[model samples]
Target: MNFSEVIKQSNQVCKVSPDGKYLATCVQYRLVVRDFNTLQIVHLYTCLDQVMHMEWSSDSLFILCAMYKRGLVQVWSLEQPDWHCKIDEGSIGLVSSRWSPDGRHILNTTEFHLRVTVWSLCTKSVSYIKYPKACQKGMDFTADGHYMALAERRECKDYISVFVCDDWHLLRHFESETQDLAGLEWSPNGCVLAVWDSCLEYKMLLYSLDGRLLSSYSAYEWSLGIKSVAWTPSSQFLAIGSYDEKVRILNHITWKKLTVFEHPAIISNSKAVLFKEMEKRAVVGSEDLSVHQLTVGNSLFSTQSKYEITQLPAKVSVVKPDPDHANPKIGISAMAFSADNRYLATKDDNMPQSVWVWDMQRLGLLAVLEQTAPIRCFVWDPRRPRLALCTGNSKVYLWSPAGCVSVNVPVEGSFQVQSLFWHCSGGSLILLSKEQLCLCYMDTEEKDQSTSSDCNFTI
Candidate 1:
């Protein structure tokens, strides 16, 4: 694996263009755009306030930066370097900013103002809407880019307002039963809108496009409510990850639980036994095995409590800790489904060997990687059948069904790999460690060589 050092310095935030041609990074108040392959600087712009957030247009032609302290947002285009547009709110600073799906409009939320402003790049016009002050991220656009859902507070009541994309007009507003709405997300097919409350509430409400409540789910009293929720690409299943250390899958058709997955508890009767003959050839020592037994009971949950969901007999899968002494007991912290939805990758909170890849269809363990450093995050390529794993240290491992390849990214100062981005073509990967951003060109020919290796095995 060969990676070109793009920026050796630390950056506050970094993003790669969707098309994978340009790499953008924000350091202090400077935003630099560079060529992905050559690592050559292309465009550079300095902001008045430190750029807190940055995003690229869908077409990858324009770069947008949000300045919270100055209450301003600057939109810069690669095509027009000298000409740039700014969205400034005088007294109330901008709290958050996002790009429309079409990349023709920019959305800005005002700090403590209970207002949201939409700016159109084509018409040079602005539209304002009332929003809830308590709802920090209570807005989302559908995947198809036709409608937008916003949760707002109206006269002490919480309501979800739907808007049309063309005119940005209110289509309908439906009041929600819960006053504290935490987050909003639209299904991949743009059929349903899911809204959930903070940890205080155990509610997950689903609504249709017309703002009608379709279905609702709640966590059990023993569980700590939901930590995150994700919809399958087909929109047939919804996976809810809860603080209770369980993953529950919901059947969208019936709006009920279909299956439950949880971390396996240690079996009291199971013992670590090694034959006298095999002990001589063993790679691990008995002392290590004894330590593993001592830490086996350190799981986050004790007794598994079943929650009611239409009384359907749920298919359950339990992920057990690795039996090997080299691996440690750790809770799952990050997970991602492959773009094809055929594979699921999960990583533990603090153990390197806790990364497991599973066949989503069969719900069976595919591979348990032997890692060195603890993993920070892992992502599957959107355009290819490959996975990239980022570790707590500045190391990244790329894996396919056949074999794995690893790379150690160099850092000038104390830093860790914060994020990874695979190019749309799957030919390159961008790694953002602290303020430094690096790009590696993936050698496709290695796939064949890796598959032929004796150590390589298929999932």
Candidate 2:
């Protein structure tokens, strides 16, 4: 299938609307809403200033934009323009921003500095936090909004600092003298925090969100830098992706390494791995196109069952004697597990540009999707199990277990596909091919068609 005529340009930071009917993208001064089924730009917005990022309100009637520049944060009521508000500004060095789970507050840094500020959307008030070092990234509000985790960088060392946001109280800090920090994340329940290092040694620390030191573990010693990290929705385990072509699932509380999944170098490019949900299981995608799943714990460290690394095809260049699996061979370039945790999909570096989907519960093969040239990047629908694969030929294929649909989208005159994102609400699908961002939806006939949508695609 070819997607050349089906794509549309979305100049905004696009998001799926809450109900799965519309796609929203933020352009220079506006947040544009499009019909998901039509892949058509339906509504246009004019949001002033450069919009850094935009997130939807729980109800879908409002959109929040974290724009760069001094002064008030912007809140837009889609139905009522007058209800929008611009929040007060704070210190410099604020490089990132995030919303609290309750959608009541916004957490952002002061430029590139170490201090974090919490802004109360309701009160329009701001609170500042101080960290020991300048931060690289990883300041996130837990799903409950009670806690925030910070990964700060100081020279070569990185510190994982946890804080109670309600009172701006310091909870604990995970530090290492030998390794520099790379990233940090909190489990869904806000019970456990995983901290990874940038050093060659496989170094990661798990901390209890309540300020307790839970445990720590390292991957095989290739010094392949840890690239990405994620926690299962159930909170029982953590998934760490590394440059070593392996993704390891660890018991959150016990620090026991449970599973190691190997991907081929071509698919993974030996970059990173991430976990997505499908039905009741967890789907993990690697820099290689290899994806797999296992049971998830409702609580941290719920799985202690031993597992050997399941080696993928020979195309996946992984070291032999991988402690976890024997013969793993799915080289993954980009991947995402469906939100329901049922389907695990991967984009491979191979020809025929394909996206593969596997049954999470069965942990076996399900379908192989092909449309254009080698799949460069793709994302799964966060609200549904659909897969959107972008290819090197500058094409996009919307794939499901049933079949594949193509959308050849280009933003302005851009060529190769760089990234693709599925809106969490299922209202829109975003394409980042080359430098420009394009938003798309199904044709007009599909606009009102409702399916079990629960996937998110992102570059």
Candidate 3:
């Protein structure tokens, strides 16, 4: 409900620490660390080159800045400003770099997916992992930060390797049933590892912590199978988005399809409430003293938006993707579960401007959000059963079981929200624009987290 001054960011690399204390953002070759609550600069450090990627260590004590083109990674400690470490891959080349779950170990993958190098800050030792596969999401660490599952490609066969993060030892290595492993993720409980195949195969397999295959599932014998996957906070249900423009919920016990939700252009359901965003230009008033609020062509006060509950049987527009395209845009590309695991929100690529929310208890659609622009990103509040989403516009939209509301980013100049991130406390949000970023402090004092039979998601 409130906003902070816009801060300039060079790259799209901005992250909040897991401890919800510091905010890190990259500007050209400088890394700026600020206090999350006060937005005051606490520390500033220079990097070797332009920062291509940036992340915070799990403990939130250190920050890592990576320059892929230069094959360099720089780590800075907040407690000891002068104590900084730099890891240079030299000519070997560095394609990806990240921190291990331990917050002390750094993992750098070489170019061409040749190998992974693990650097330890505590032990000052180096460990090398071979056969690292080049995929979208090939590496994942469990929630407890104890184990890591890595997808590997060995002799034309797909494999998975589980390693203990304490010493980076190979605990288990086994061949995967996937023809081409696309992505893999560990459940929130860290009990099961879910691996899905490429767009060509509609196969999904679940494996145990010890590399034993637990379950296999396939929705249909079609292409562009699984686009996205999400596990409930409780890890009781696994939601998989597929190319068929549907989301299939699988129970943790059976891992079988418990229910399927489809996105139809025509919505005639009475149980679902549809909130459509409407934008209109504000009529400039001749309030002589307030002329300072005006800009050259358009300013923050130029236009405003609001959400109106539209009548049922509404027809939403859909953009059909070309079949010959490399990555067709016609599937359920995004999904998120509420922190309480009571609601599920999804976005279908074909209906770019729509977001659907489903109820897990009644197992039905609750509300539908139809925006004027494509839904860029949506995330659930960590503390409650609320959802916040952003379009490539100057406003942020939110939905809850109680109702829906759209708030404009009160700022001068054009600050279109490209994406958004929520603070761990869910009391504030970091809204990123083209080259600017701002923090949105939510007004939770007046609002209560009470839900009625009718919620904020539409079918």
Candidate 4:
């Protein structure tokens, strides 16, 4: 695949619309929206200050840009290009902002978490929720966009707040077991909510939408507590990654431990684990470790007793050297499922030069990719099976079953590639380095067919 460089400079990270038709990025003090296929500017808005952050509405009809110097936010709609809405926090300043799942409301937090403001586009009004103290973790909106959950500190205690999105009314507020809450997340199906204590405590609490605590879990005292939590797409199982180098899957129905996946590198910490639910199977990827494919029979209607978990054999193995100063610690740094759910990518923390791609259907290694420099991160196209990987030397490698292509991004000073975002159609990619943002378009059909088969690998 050949990639043509589009935008060479940008202020902040770029975001793609949900449908992959448009790309939004901040060019200094202006927000520029461009056509994903043509790389032509379609809409541009100049803000009062440099744009610090940008988020697209779920429906891809609106773009929200946050100003850096001033604590202000600007919302732009595609239908009305001349008219725009502004959100400002007078003295406190805006700390962060989020768009509701339904793309109807905008949520903003004041500087120091002094308060939270909910802005509705349809009503053209705003509501406020005062905070007694600053919260480390912010609020979360359910997948269905009907409810919002957040943790607040009140009078030396931490309480979880659930709000109804329709009227922005406080649905319920309940005190958790520990006042030191760390995170809050609602299941994808919007049936349950999970809250966990900070690393100081190993308690994980599950609650219903009505604020009733359904179950609580604790890690062994010797463990370092839960590092991260992820719910299966079906909301039937919750995977918790602990510092003890083990991932525990819990059945929501039974509220009991279903199974545990032990990683090979005990010293390598797990930042996150991912689960991809396919037709009749599920793929689990553990950080710095391995990937397991399980045959989840009757996952939709059955309980934990009826599920089957199987660990796939090692398709690709890394050579581990003795732990010494010369050989840095090794672990799985990153992993992602392809858009089609047929390929899986895994990267090692120490060996950034290599990446492993697995075929989920056949449960085997598909390809092993090696690069000139250590890989910083990689993202799969949301609409295609193509993969884009960024390395430490400011280069990106695009891979597919057809072939592989590498692009070297020009750099002026000392900056590294930070992240990458793909347009919904998988034709455009936005690369954010430390200093600038760039846009690149991929032509999958125009690549040299003679060389396409040269990089092909089969297992």
**Winner by lDDT:** 3
lDDT of 2 at 456: 23
**Number of the predicted model whose TM-score against the real structure is largest:** 3
For model 2, how does the per-residue alpha-carbon lDDT over 1-459 read when each residue is reduced to its tens digit?
113232433443656765667766665666667676665776566666667788876667777777667533577776775566766555463455666656667766666465767777677777776663442336666787777777765555666667776666778775543366655677788777776666456687777765566676765676455655656566765666665545566765467987655543333322221111111223433232211122346421111111111222213322233447633323233445677767665443322234445565654455544342345567777666666766554455565554444433432243555677765555455666433555555432233332222222222
What's the true lDDT of residue 221 in model 2?
74
Q: Per-residue lDDT tens digits of candidate 4, residues 1-459?
A: 334454544654588788878877777788888887777999988888888889999999999888745988889999889888888877888878889887888888887788888889898888889863454454888887898887888888888888888787889988877748888889878988888887667888999999888999885775447666766556766767665545566787888887655444222222221111112223333331111123356332211111111123312233554656652445444556675657667665544456656565554455555554456778888777788877654455677776565544533333356778776666667777765666665664544343242343210
Deviation from native of the Cα of residue 78 in model 1, angstroms = 1.6
- The reply for model 4, stretches above 4 Å from the true place, is 132-136, 265-375, 383-388, 397-416, 426-428, 435-459
Cα error, residue 155 of model 1, in Å, equals: 3.9
Task: Count backbone overlaps in model 1.
Answer: 2
lDDT of candidate 3 over 106-159, digit per residue (tens): 999999999999999998899999999999899999999999999999999999
Candidate 1, residues 1-61, lDDT tens digits: the string is: 5656447543448788888788888878888898877768899998887888999998998
Model 4: pairs clashing at backbone N, Cα or C within 3 Å: 20-424, 288-331, 288-332
Q: lDDT score of model 1?
A: 0.68
Q: Which ranges of candidate 3 are over 4 A from the true structure?
A: 286-301, 446-459
CA lDDT, every model vs. true structure: 0.68, 0.55, 0.88, 0.67
Query: TM-scores of the models, in the given order?
Result: 0.78, 0.65, 0.94, 0.72
Arranged by lDDT with the best first, the candidates are 3, 1, 4, 2
